[model samples]
Target: MSPLKSYLDLYKHLPQTNCKKCGMAACLAFAAAAMRGQKLLSACPDLAPQVREELARELGQAADPQEELTRAMAPLKARVAAVDLAAKAGQLGCTHNGKRLVLKCLGKDFTVDPDGSLASQCHVNAWLAEPMLNYVSLGQGKDPLGRWKLLRELPGGEDWHRLFGQRCEKPLQKVIDEHRDLMEWVIDIFGAQAVEEEGSAELRVVLWPLPKLPLLIRYWPPEDGMESTLNLCFDATATDNLPIESIYTLGVGLVTMLEKIALTHDT
Candidate 1:
């Protein structure tokens, strides 16, 4: 991240008051210098020397964090990057009428259990639902291809599919059904152009007698919290002719997929 961005993030979290006791006119200016390494911790007289010392210590600890992070993240990064690249290349899956059909592996086959707790069992599902939620709110006028391009660069994404696969047990359909229901709503709202036909494993498209919009499918495992999966499908055509930068702007396939589905329904 750039110094400016770092400063901005810190600034947002700061007490927005311009007390001037910090020697700077505003917290933002102080943050800017802190980010640029142009200001010293003691520069802020407003903060007690003890507080400044503590903050400085914390910042110093994080100064060389990138190297450590790189080491810890190397393996997972590669896996996610590959998937992201595939998604942008239109390889991982396809879309129709702006809706997307995602390949889902239920907990039966690959599930992620956090701390072996029941309350936490739904964490992963909730984590995956964020993009879907965003799509529901802003699907219309969205560029699905652009979104995929941006998603390719996001972190933690490289491990998403791999982690899911590892935790899964058997491919379940119930999860897919949940995901499908969510995407279907987006498709119905957006007036999509194409969709992934229910029960089909192949990535295919069509305009005439347009396939169903916002299709939902699921693979539910017999076990309770093992590894159920959700597969959400949408129209793919919305992304076919998009440009690279546009794709970047669209930012993240998961969300874009939902948006496309919603947009199709709206139209």
Candidate 2:
């Protein structure tokens, strides 16, 4: 069967209530959108994990904006110098995997909605310090980002033995240490400039897919009569399929919004 026909067949199995919650009327509609490379797998709330995984695999095999960015910039983790970043920050553009990108982010600003009505979601940020040294025994497929790394490290490290003389065992101590270390690294990697404003605060964070573009995130209070905006700025050459720091950006952005909300409410 043709690729589009295959996807439509899968969609036929999906619950097609046309809920519109998934941004489409029915599963077939979503499948078409997916074929067109326009919608994300996450958009379908009704999809089970297995289904989602299947779709993601299929999508990865297909052309995508993210893949396009990846080819232009090379994996999201490839580092770029400050001067390059500055030039890209002013103007960045990239294309990969059949996706086109063109934009400029310099001098752009984001303001929070003054009404305090922006839809926010729950988030979690977990980090592991003193990474687990042991290889997790994966029976088959690739192990998930060092899931078993902590098991061996928990017993004793240089510092742990130094303090306890190798006699005591502290449970979950390693876990705590790892998480703290991760958070510290995160903060160091994405430090913000101090800018005080009544209704809005501006911060920038590195997003991988487009090294030339730094995401400008803002928080504003409803009382200030501003709408919150997250701007992804890029030069004309910024690439597609770049890995986004989605978790960190969204999690931290939400916290910043809450802080602003508290400040506004108090006043």
Best by TM-score: 2
Using all chains and alpha carbons, the TM-scores for the candidates as numbered come to: 0.22, 0.27
Q: What tens-digit string does per-residue lDDT give for candidate 2 at 1-267?
A: 223356666576567766544434456777776666555666566777676666667666323545532332221212221123223222333212222122211222211121211111222111100000000010011212211211123322222222221111121122222232332333343343333455544433333212232332222212366533332232222112121222122223333433443344435
Q: For all candidates, what are the clash counts?
A: 72, 31
- On a 0 to 1 TM-score scale, where does candidate 1 land against the true structure? 0.22
In model 2, which runs have C-alpha deviations exceeding 4 angstroms? 1-7, 17-29, 33-45, 49-187, 198-212, 220-267
Candidate 2, run of 10 with poorest lDDT: 129-138
lDDT of 1 by residue, 30-102 (tens): 7776666544545454555555555656555232344423332333333333332223323322231222233
lDDT of each: 0.34, 0.32
